[model samples]
Target: MFLRTPPLTAALLSLALLYSASAATHAKENAIASAKESIASSEKDSTASSAKKSIASDSYTYANLHDVRVSHVYLDLTVDFANNALTGFADLTLDWQQQDADTILLDTRDLTIKQVYARRVDGQWRKVSFELAERHAVLGSKLTIKPGFQTQTLRIHYQSQPQASGLQWLTKEQTASKNQPFMFSQNQAIHARSWIPIQDSPAVRLTYSARIQTDKDVLAVMSAPTEPGTARTGDYRFTMPHAIPPYLLAIAVGDLEFKAMSAQTGVYAEPYILEAAAKEFASTQQMIDVTEPLYGDYRWGRYDLLILPPSFPFGGMENPVLSFITPTVIAGDGSLVNLIAHELAHSWSGNLVTNATWQDLWLNEGFTSYVENRIMEQVFGVDRAIMEQALSVQDLKQELQSIDADDSRLFLDLKGRDPDDAFSGVPYTKGQLFLMFLEKRFGREVFDPFVKKYFDDHSFKSITTAEFERYLAANLLDQHPGKVSSEEVNEWIHGRGLPASSPNPQSDAFLRVQQHSNAWLSGLSTLSELPTTAWTVHEWLFFLNNLPLNITPTQLQQLDQAFNLTHSSNSEIAHAWYLLALKTGYRQVLPALEQYLISIGRRKLILPLYRQLASTPEGLAFARKVYQQARPGYHPLAQGSVDEMLKAD
Candidate 1:
């Protein structure tokens, strides 16, 4: 799923402004397209050469992949809960790209390297000399080892620091099962360097195997598929047969119990949340059943979910085979299962075919989001899917207003910046919009096959935006002449904002909800008279989102009184209501909001609330006070983001 940020304050105006582009805008687009086409025509050969070079260049990592590449990683690690660290050695099998190269460089962050050993072609392991380079604020330190010529493997013994960015160690009190501690890894976007010493670039794909030792009382899981009837002993083994990017490497240790949702799908959570999570996500098999016939077969053997504690930073991290999900999504009614669909779609778009660099993140996210909506439409009704799309578009428009034009492009230039900071609604939503444009122009009959073939052709590979464009042109656009021009595609990818021809998702359900919202805000009807009992989560979000920006405190109170929103069991509805309460200065909701912030640690839900609270002096003090108490429970990523946000305020 895309990183969730707060919606812009002037969402209604932003939506109007996005859709109502003036004639001059069209003229400018044509001019820009013509110029871009000319430049592309001139630089076609150089551009191809540059594209090949860029495919291997990743700004995020210090690994020199051109010299030596990592083929497979074998981790023999022990979970040390007392020290809040993982102490072990990683045996990395190397593929010598340059025969003359004798040195291998790997990425590391806040790790203490004790020793290094190299395995020669004769199968003898000998101690090797290594150096830890100066630390980089973002890229971490580079561990360089001179294993000598003809060495095919290296074993690096290291220990992770307590404050490693990727791994979060939670105290027993921070877990649902208060009797045991929990630890999980969130390694996307370069955080993997903090825990494991490897080529931490998405451009390099490698298979991995692990033997993780944890407390005998707790269960341990990895991104790899687990064998049926595996022993529950402290020593656990896993193997990921297919090669994947390092960021997809994941591990979790907790007092987890599993319940089968289907023959291949299951839920793993603490005893407290296992049943609820399983019930809420009972449709996992249906999602896979529907997605496989459209896309290719499910390449990864089994698809299971691990419901992490509330402190899991993202809504869901699409770790292969086993996805790390936040507990906040178990809303009892399964209203938020779209998040599941989004993550499952990543099985194809992201895990099977990945983005070569963070700059082309749209290749992973945009494709997944488009496929997610398709899955939603297939499983849930079209009305629900359209409502979700409309909400996404609304959020994107608001996000575009604040995001810089350069960052707004589907092809981002995040050379000197952190990819995490560069995230926004642009890649996920705008990329989806680009595909929707193509789908609309060339009907699904033509587009569906293309999507299926695209996934099949690029399975188990990392690709760049240029590579995808070339494939699209050859397979889809060129095959069906006069359907879409290269210029239009260029605009969607390289242009600052949405193109004039962008598809606008409209929902009849949201329209009716807006009508009721307008009626109540205009004083034509009382809140108690509105028909909300039958409303779904999507309808509630639309209703609350379209409420007038200047809604008074009394108006908020009336809505809360009638709907009991402040006390709603649904996390989505409660978050929307809390945002409104903060905006309207309704102090009655403060206690609930504070409790909500403390209990839930999903960045998407909590970041916006904290930002809203920091909008005023009194609220800022309250936010700080609450954050001090809530800080221990938050994951390192959440803690860092919230700290930066509050510090900036």
Candidate 2:
């Protein structure tokens, strides 16, 4: 993972030694237990606002939280599957840092407020006056409540609207086990307001506990640890000792079962998919073991993965304990399991040390991406990690060309814009390259320690870009002035385009594949002559992606005949093949491509297909036809992307 900077090799070796020594003495069990206790005691100022002032963000939340903080939250909810809504009460424990603070505001969307009450040391719930601010089209309404000065607890009884953006209610037809309905929540980038009333900002972190009552036939799971012996009682109690931003508060209810991969790691899916999920992610526990030395510890009690039905929006969400994953990655060949590494890395980068605001999202994603590659290199192989890195760079370059210059920068200005606009590959890829840049310049020996220290210091806290920059300056630059400078770092973080010092990712296997692709396109090699056996999915993707644009239908047919790519089971390879097929007018893949579109809801794979398919009138017709049928099976987030792409056409 290091370049030929003169001192880097020594630095890398020394870093490994340092990590080994420190990890040997690290008390992981104690740390996790202490964190849980701290969460139970509500001793953290986890809800402190970001270093940036509230005005710095374009969020609709009206409260100035500098004087008051919510320390912990309790959710008592009942799932009404018939009505597709949540009838619940949220009890927020507040710490009034300022004696003069009498009123507080929380964000809400499409929610009907039933009652508001407050209690103090006297322990009596008294009625509290509250007002709902005029709602914005996208930002939702703000619930302003007068809880009186120094009020310790504020409780609101409310019911979420059926159309709450965060909650997705699916019919039995949408699930793998067609006999049961499914429900899950996606609350990132401010959607939490749509389901639960809270200070919905990444800056505001708080410990939470939940009591969810669901149908007896369904299993209830949340971001917290599952309460014992409640599986059959229809009453589930869970607690999370670690404080997290509201967006990370997740819940799902379904006919689900768990299968353990190791003592502390496992998988959850429907009865039919459980075994495959368990096998597909068997490397997860090892990923955790590999990652602990790189960072300090896995503070989260247990790490499990929940494989959502096809329509789950993202590849993986780094939910504490349970990482919600898309079923598409269970390719049966295990080539896609690196996604598990990416999410597990978030246990440290995102779940432990979070970005204070969406503008600084790179802090969460970029670091996670880098750590993911490192873990993949250790647990999978170096070549596998290199292949993924090259793919990431390809994506980053394409994204840079397509997006606005300002939007391509590592530090983003998402003010007055939907934060989702900034959730592209830039943060994940460009951010990783930025860290790679530093590692190359300063050497891994010096850089690795800084990363471990960064997480150690910022664990359970949200940080801003400015804070990170200052920290880097104090830790890395001040100690080794000649290695890297603040001005050079700024060019990577704030300036547009890849910096001159950006890491050039090179994979030997990818290089050979590219050469073969060039030779085939140049008429120097025949398809039958190429060394086709022993190729992994990454090699196939490199070959397909590097194929000549505007390929002739004959060439596409030759490839299809030789590789059977149009019917490939691997989603990664199939996606690449389908895109080339569409471009080359290889009509044979039309049905398979359409079926692929219908079967998978991963935005990374489908949106690009839909966008490319919409280019021609006939293609647009087919895309629209498929979308009309597929829309019901997609999560709102995925549907929203496709809807806009089709709408524009």
Clashing pairs in 2: 11-445
CA RMSD per model (angstroms): 14.1, 8.9
lDDT of 2 by residue, 438-528 (tens): 8888888988999999999988788889889999999999999888888898998999989888998999998888888788888999998
lDDT per residue (tens digit) for residues 1-649 in model 1: 1111112212322322332343435354334223323322343222111122334588888888878777667787999999999999887766666667888889999999999987654445689999999999888899988877756667789999999999999989998789789999999889999999989988887766677888898889999877544556888777665678999999999888888998888998898988999999999899998998888788777889999999898999999999999988899999999999999999999998999999989999999999999999999989999999999999999888977888889999986887787568898999999999999999999999999999989777888989999999999989999999999999999999999998899998888888888888889988877788788899999888778769988888788888788998888889988888888778999888889998889998999899999889999999999999999999998999899878942
lDDT for predicted candidate 1 compared with the true structure: 0.84
Tell me each candidate's TM-score. Answer: 0.91, 0.91
Best prediction by lDDT: 1
- Quantify all predictions' global Cα lDDT against the true fold: 0.84, 0.81
| Model 2 misplaced stretches (Cα beyond 4 Å) | 1-60, 227-230
How does residue 176 of candidate 1 score in lDDT? 75
TM-score of 1: 0.91
